[model samples]
Target: MTSPDEDRRTGAVHAVAAYGLWGMLPLYFVTLAPAGSLEILGCRILFSVVVAAILIRWQHGWGRMRTALRDRRVMLTLAAAAALIFVNWLTYITAATSGHVVETSLGYFINPIVTVLLGVVVLRERLRPLQWAAIGVSALAIVVLVVAYGQVPVIALTLAFSFGLYGLLKRQVSGRVDGLSGLAIETILLIPAAGLLIAVVSSWGQLTLLDHGPVHFALLAFSGIATLVPLLFFAGAAKRLPLAHLGLFQYLAPILQLLTGVLILHEPMPATRWIGFAIVWLAVFMLVADVLIVGRRGRA
Candidate 1:
């Protein structure tokens, strides 16, 4: 058996790989240019089912999938998860391809705050003082962005809330569902909607999957594997790492995304937007500090 230290090291590696892949997703999505978001989303859903099937068979998880499907509660929860993830994926794909990657990064930056708020509202969990302060700072940051942009940051908010709720729904069925099985069920649930999207996009003549050469078609086909690999890594990490460590690792994705937007994509970030992001970063700092302090006290 591996020692705890070795397990943690392995988990750290997995966590880094997962978040790193997620961070670089904007780059991948951008490369699929000429393929509209709906078309890409549809293909992602359809092909993910194919990939999930192969993985399920490889892992011998057919039994678990059947068990989950038979449980009404599990199926309902996963159905809800499927819808939320559909929204999250669509929003992210649109933003990434439309040069709004910075704003997309902002959405994820505040996701921890949204998750905390959901815990308060949905789980009836109490927050520490720092957590409350962090929320306040995040709120201020939103106000700053609204004033600066002369409108709500709809993309950021939508991505944040959709993903936050998605995470909550996943938690509801986590006990009964393995990551691969859960994803398989969720993707299966989305098949009809995915088909409809493909039909609609094709009608509009915006479906570029076939118009593009074989290279583009191959990339679209590989979307399923791209989606599944990181999730599997995340699952492995979660099983091996402490929650606190996992939570901290979540920041890597947004940070990389922000860098990709500003440094690589040359997305403009004016002073006001920088200030808003700085405020959000401050809030994130408080949350991290709170976690560390509370964890230390627990150890003590």
Candidate 2:
């Protein structure tokens, strides 16, 4: 049996890998050339479905898939999540490919604030001072961006809101599907539609992977590993760690994403984005700090 201490470590690691993959996704998605954003989306969905299917078969999750399918409400909730994530992926890929990495970075940076906002609106939870300040600073960043860029940071907002709502929806589903099984169910539902989209793009000679060499196919397949590994790790950690602690691990991804945008991608923040990021991060730091401190005091 896994020890609680081990579980906590695993959870922390899971959160890091999950978010790290998400942050580095721009690298994976943008590296494929000659493919439109939507085309790449289709390929990802298709390939993911194929990979999800094989994993399901290996894990003998067919029975679970059948059960999830019969459950209309649960299926619908996941479907909603799928739609939101699909849009999120597309926008992220487009932004990364289009040299708007910083814009994409902003979306993820503020995602935590978005999650807090959901608790306020949907869960009717009262925000702590740190939470409120986080929101306020995040709001200031948005104001700065709109004032300077003249266009709303729609990509960032879409990513933040959709992912926030997706998490909310996932929280509502009481019966936990194993990570692999959940993905299989979600991918199975999405496969037919993804096929149609791929066909459309292929007809237009727009699908990028078709003419690419073996290396391209190899990279595409890596996406399956990239998609699956962290999710399973998170599921593993969830079994071991308390929600209070596992929850904190999530910030690692966006933080890494922000770092990547600044250091690796070399995307400029300008004065506006720089100020915006500072405020947003300050709020998150305070909120997370409060959580950690309170947690330790409770233990004491």
Each model's lDDT comes to 0.95, 0.76
The digit string of per-residue lDDT tens for model 1 on 1-300 reads 999999999999999999999999999998888898999899999999999999999999999999998999999999999999999999999999999999999999999999999999999999999999999999999999998778999999999999999999999988998889999999999999999999999999888888889999999998898899999999999999999989999999999999999999999999999999999999999999999999899999
Off by over 4 Å in 1: none
Candidate 2 lDDT tens digits, 1-300: 878777677777777767677778777776777677777777777777777888778878889878877788888888887887777777887887777777777777777788889999999999877678778877887887787678998888998898888788877774755567666666666777778877898888777674788888777667667777777777766777777777777776776667767787787767866776777677778778868877898899
Candidate 1 C-alpha error for residue 272, in Å: 0.6
- Could you tell me which 10 consecutive residues in candidate 1 have the lowest summed lDDT? 146-155
Please give the TM-score that candidate 2 achieves against the real structure: 0.91
Cα deviation in Å at residue 150, candidate 2?
Answer: 2.9
Compare the candidates by TM-score and give the number of the best one.
1
- As a whole number from 0 to 100, the lDDT of residue 46 in candidate 2 is 75
Clashes of 2: 0
**lDDT value for model 2:** 0.76
